[model samples]
Target: MITKQSVIGFIGTGVMGKSMARNLQKEGFPLHVYTRTKEKAAELIEHGAVWKNSVQELAASSDVIITMVGYPQDVEEVYFGEAGILENAKEHTYVIDMTTSKPSLAVDIYRKAKEKNIFALDAPVSGGDIGAKNGTLAIMVGGDEDVFQRMMPIFEVLGENIRLQGGAGSGQHTKLANQITIASNMIGVCEAIVYAKKAGLNPEKVLESISTGAAGSFSLSKLGPRMLKGDFAPGFYVKHFIKDMTIALESAKEMGLSTPGLELSLRLYKELAEKGEADSGTQALIKLFE
Candidate 1:
């Protein structure tokens, strides 16, 4: 059973991972962190997290391991090889991959981990960097119900809205559904701002009227102002968002789904990336409209 005494190993200390790991530490869990870049884990180290030199070292020592790496390939690298978590983690160690990756990969990880008596879960999260910083992320989990129950304490420490969707890969499937909604919603959000500005209406005032009504959304309320102020910072990277859309699009096609909105959004994001805005925030899509 997981408790405050469980040593939690966290990999990928990027914009979202860093804050999520820090929250786990604040709740008094002993944290061991590893990232490809040592400098990224520096702050966590200074804040009393134990730093491991590699994934193997961290896996061997920790009771529970959490990974928030970029891309499915990175997930495979951290969990598949002889040096990976499945080989190195102690028997029955609970390994959770919170990265938004392909559902099939999550299922593969689950089967390999189960073979070695490891408990694996795909527990991808939403709410972006702000949600990570605030500990209010919506965590969608996929695993055995008993395992999900066992990890509730740890999940509670990291997020407020946590649910076990179904078996292995369900979490990833749910996250893709989330990205699909956001992909289309982002386009609407950008268009609304552009229309208000072009028509000589104060966009801020217009937002005040529409944001609380039927047109309101997280993208409009949280990111709309950032677009207006030219704050194209990386709350979530465009390159990563594009990666997610590509995965979603591929998954949709495999299921015989036609997603015109998703297709359009993907095309626009690719165009933005081609113009060197790949590292910018999703809110930076407003630049295309401008």
Candidate 2:
């Protein structure tokens, strides 16, 4: 049972982070939030979250600091910058990063946190904006089992499924595996939607049939209708998805693994982003085919 005394410091109020923080707050944890823009902090504040001005301020005050920032650079700034969390983090703090960043960066941050006797985890998450909003995200966490278990109740408020996959950087690795599947799945859903539209079948009916079968995917069931409607509002931004795919491909290259399909998917997403689709939802990949 997490109390109001547990100051939930969430350092990234972007689409998914905001929803995750809002859900945590709704479940009764007092929140301390920081984002680059004050305007971006607006929604969280209205939902019973207290806004903090800087990452260090959030770190110094909070019992548990959770970061959901974007990219490797964003993670660095939040945890290791001049006024970063690491520089100011107090003892008995459990620092959890929910960012989908490079595994190497996660390892670097974890070592630094350990030197300070702070318990930190690389706990990246999946299930997109909808999942974050609904508190049903599938979380992949990597930390000491004791720290992971201690944080379990808090994670329960933010995600439907949580697993402590392994140590150090395992969460990010699991997230890469997750992105590999999501990339392939998005392509399948995109092609299916395009094919159904041209074949004179109501894509919705086709969606119903495929969804209950083994052919089903989250993309097909949740985002297919929106793709058919041509609405590109973000459920998961194409930019973020492309970043995850690129990270997975880089990891594959380092380990000498073959993933031609992921390479192809990465290229397609880059083309979509270059054509100005970065901010749109991943479902907008269907527009690339159209």
Best by lDDT: 1
Q: What is the C-alpha RMSD of each candidate to the true structure, in Å?
A: 0.7, 1.3
lDDT of 2 by residue, 193-280 (tens): 8899899899889998999899877888889888878889998888988889999999999999999889889999999999999999
Give the poorly placed runs of model 1, Cα more than 4 Å off.
Answer: none
* Clash count per candidate: 0, 0
- Could you give candidate 1's per-residue lDDT for residues 137-254 as a string of tens digits? 9999998999999999999988999999999999999999999999999999999999999999999999889989998888989999999899999889999999999999999999
Error of 1 at 68 (Å): 0.3
Which stretches of candidate 2 lie above 4 Å from their native place? none
Error of 2 at 101 (Å): 0.8
Cα misplacement distance, residue 279 of candidate 1 (Å): 0.9
**CA lDDT, every model vs. true structure:** 0.95, 0.88
